[model samples]
Target chain A: MSETGDGSLSPARPSRGMFGVSGSSDTSGFNGLATPVHADLSTPKPYGSWYDEATDHLAEVFGGFGDAIERIVVDRGELTLHVKREHILELCRTMRDDPSLRFELLSSVSGVDYIDSPRRLHAVYHLTSMTYRRRLRLEVATTVEDPHIPSVVSVYPTADWHEREAWDFFGIVFDGHPALTRIQMPDDWIGHPQRKDYPLGGIDVEYKGAHVPPPDERRSYA
Target chain B: MTTTDTPGTGASPTDPFAPSRDTTEGRIFTLVGGDWDSLTDEAISGTEKMVVNMGPQHPSTHGVLRLVLELEGETVTECRLVIGYLHTGIEKSTEYRNWVQGVTFVTRMDYLAPLYNETAYCLAVEKLLGITDDIPERATVIRVLVMELQRIASHLVWLATGGLELGAMGMMLYGWREREVILEILELITGLRMNHAYVRPGGVIQDLPPGAVDKIREFLVYMPKKIKENEGLLAGNPIWAARNKNVGVIDASGCVALGVTGPLLRAAGLPWDLRKQEPYCGYETYEFDVPTRENGDCWARFEVRVAEMRESLKIIEQCLGKLRPGPVMIGDKKIAWPAQLALGSDGMGNSLDHIRNIMGTSMEALIHHFKLVTEGFRVPAGQVYVPIESPRGEMGYHVVSDGGTRPYRVHVRDPSFVNLQAVPAMTEGSMISDVIAAVASVDPVMGGVDR
Candidate 1:
């Protein structure tokens, strides 16, 4: 339960590195700025036109899985269902098979590392229902120690490469993936490069009598 | 001794084909170890399979794309696509820069359709700022115009490369010749032929230059005739028809299952276009049709792309009619760029009048410019995903901001990446020669795929 500058419990610990180097000068000028970490968001009922009906239907259909549904968030005119990690597979199957919630096309599967939260890794799935002309987002989060989520390839075969990509960049393990090798990086490369703590590996540039520091080494206003 | 007495026979362990070689380097090995008659009989029996790698560096792959194929004779038994040779890590680099600088990074991802990338990213930023409605009418119209024009250019590249792959070299020449006209128009407006970071957050970088409209009108009159001639060359040719018809077929169900969209999905008989279904950037007002085909093969994709170019022409004509003179950028000085940009001797820069005002007389204008340029305006803490139809398919940007000048995380769901997943399914059982047609039909720009 380490606390950040704002006194909120953050899972992310301050690294010994300065902008990714083990020991370097801290050139980022952030004394006057405050980094705003987002708290969990929730919306009130009657959440616009199609949102209310969709949530009500989801709740009615998955009545048996109590507390598996953590929360339903409607923000920026989009609906998101934050489900527990264990029940994500069942939820995806139900969402894909249900006639009312036929999200037939899995548009994207992306991973976001929220290093400040208890569940440090988040897997976001964007599902598109061409039949109903609607879109839904399903998210599941897990910690670094136990970053395992069931593969939804059985339900959406398109998740094969996407799951591999997520695993490649975020170090989130998808259990039962056929071949979970790196898709974007070299197979022998070490460390997930997209993590918040991972340093942006940029080198200083020397060009035409001018010297420019790398992005991480440059002054930061955040 | 009698068997080894053949001419050039030397029973060398290092050279397996010692008996057949006339020169030292001419060691030609055969699959059959013992007798040619037995190997020929076995080959005729159809039980041999070989593995071959097509490219990460061959022509006709459209870019640096590698395909590994398992062939039984000439027919392919299995196909595997190996991408990531062109990985630029643009998304990871975007995290370190501010929001305003992100446009330059994203516009390079799908190099064929740079406007779609900028529009999607800007729309997401505006959504996070809750200023979707505040964008000026002229800006939106210009966005629609440039995006449609980009679509035409992208489809023409697809046509040109696809034609070259299928041995229709004349079509390749015609397609590029027609596409050059559009690129000149783009350069006239945006000042770059490719990777034009013209579309900024609040609006475009600058209003359209003079005579740009007349040039577009000239293009509108000239492009249709060229498209007709190009189609006439390939649409009825027996060789082209035989090469494309029923090759690499994926039906509507398969397309949905594999998350394929755009011309690939439309060619599969589903008219699920994001512009028509979701209607971003006031696309609903523009009258056009979503061209579709029932065949869902390489030929269908080719036909759909050509028809789509025609439809884009219609949209561009409407945009020409809808053009009105007004402010392009938003009035809000806080979020909008402070300087009005103009083409200078070196490159594009702030206009002389604004620079003079800030430098000489107006201290307030100087401070405003300094603050806006140094630290960009902050967006509210939230996450949003905005999808727009590019020439390839649905291009989406999932932007997360933590109420800072820089983005927390940004992930681009590029259509080229998603549609490339269907290559294995489409080319698994097809002939080895058909792989070129299938990959070209996908029209994957590897910049978008590997980014």
Candidate 2:
């Protein structure tokens, strides 16, 4: 829920002579003019300086592992960490129990297929720490050939269905899941349909007389 | 109020693992399947238990969710939840559509927080393309305003349904009344009520309409008072307190361990709001507070959402006040089309580019336009993950692009799906009625879950 960069995020200047407030420190205008009715509530802090110490501390603890962390971008108010596959579960476990990095909540687990990239698949974890008032992301890249990642269901019970979904759609196998059944798609359905290479509308063998047109051949409403 | 009953009397006799039988392995040798049915029937009838299906279509489920409940009188012995009644396969279909067209498809999935879905997808695409900063200010403001509005709308539905579950019929009516105003605003801006494809790549579909600002202002002024009135209606009521207070309790440790977020996490006495901690969409600019409660009960979640609506109102007001003039879309003409093209006027090829393409270059403009619309833009070969705080919790997109027009992998981390897991832990030893209260408190929207 990061606010887009509008001037509203920064703390408003008080009105008058008192720091940034108006005339009498009660209602006086910033200048000599009449008092304004309302106060601007938006508060802005220097972005980099605000979270620098805490983030730096975590980075220090991460030490050599920091090099494998590809992207550490903040957007729309979330701090996302793009870690390679080998370190994802360890990072999650550390983030969960570490005093400073108490990301106890494993909020979500899902898979994304980067079919075009050298490492073709990604498992994304969203974690929140109630104690630290922070949120962190962990990402791992794997290829389609061996799309396997350790399951976090042992840590977070909610990972059960989420892992099943990733397996059902993208075909990313959670190695230690209790039951990786198709939660959405029928259990017998073939192919990981959500994979980019999977056809949008496959040949309807039941309707052998007709051909299902590809996406572009259909009518355009726009 | 304590009822002490024997724990394992109902275990099957002929099955040997049945509780009615002795624990030793020697007891198993004495029993066989032939007389087991009669023995189990007699033991079960004496013990008293029943099995009931709550829904693939029950009102308390809030959507098409089926819960199989094994109950011993008023207490639940075991519960199994069944889902997937509304699987549209939007993720599968996304591979077939172009990148831009995927916005409309993803927006329809959650239904409650459409903008969050659109933003996550756009961020992933931008990451893959290495064009994160191409989004313009106006588009950003529109995105913030709409997303906040969606959050408000989503919380309203949660409040409405939560109230209905508590037997407070008036709350649902009033909650929905406020929600319709937000929907009207969405329709006015995006042309659709629930799923608005207004937030697209590079920028939004179009700019806000004239008079949209004033309407939002009026709604902002009117909403807080209505919120207070609704709060008064339920906040101090005796039955409401009794039904909600200690029922379905989950502490902060359990919440964090289970991956819960949004109000549910806040209600557990944590200030882990994505807006405050992560600061997406300029939420840092808005003057508002993240409401939190320590009880971690059904009532606490209800209180958090009620307070969140007020904070959201403050945000909407700030956005409207600062609604300055600027272009909504970014990037050169190569990526996004110029905003001035008329529909029918292009039919006769009256434009210069049309003439150049038709007479000189063999309809190259038409071909490029066709390809752009048909195949969509190809993204670089990479992966990007983006997360947003929707009303449910952390809504995120994990995108993988293979240098193709369609996304190679697009997965949504829907909050409802994550939050639903908290149900079993919350309901384990509770009475059957409290199970309803517990679920309503967590506020799982099955649309997001089943997706």
lDDT of 2 by residue, A88-138 (tens): 666666666668877776666767665545766667777756666565667
- Over the stretch A1-222, how does candidate 1's per-residue lDDT look in tens digits? 001112121112232221122232322313324253645645556677688788788878976455887766777777778889888888888889899989998999899987777887999999998888898898899999999999998889999889988998999999988888898887887888888877777556679988898877789856
* Cα misplacement distance, residue B99 of candidate 1 (Å): 0.5
Cand. 2 Cα-lDDT: 0.72
Cα lDDT of model 2 by residue, B69-95, tens digit: 888767887877777888888877776
Q: Could you tell me the lDDT of residue B77 within candidate 2?
A: 79
Q: What is the lDDT, from 0 to 100, of the residue A115 in candidate 1? A: 75
Chain A TM-scores, one per candidate? 0.76, 0.65
Error (Å) of candidate 1 at residue A127 is: 1.3
* Candidate 2 local lDDT, residue A6: 24
Best by lDDT: 1
DockQ of model 1 vs. true complex: 0.30
Among incorrect, acceptable, medium and high, the docking class of model 1 is acceptable
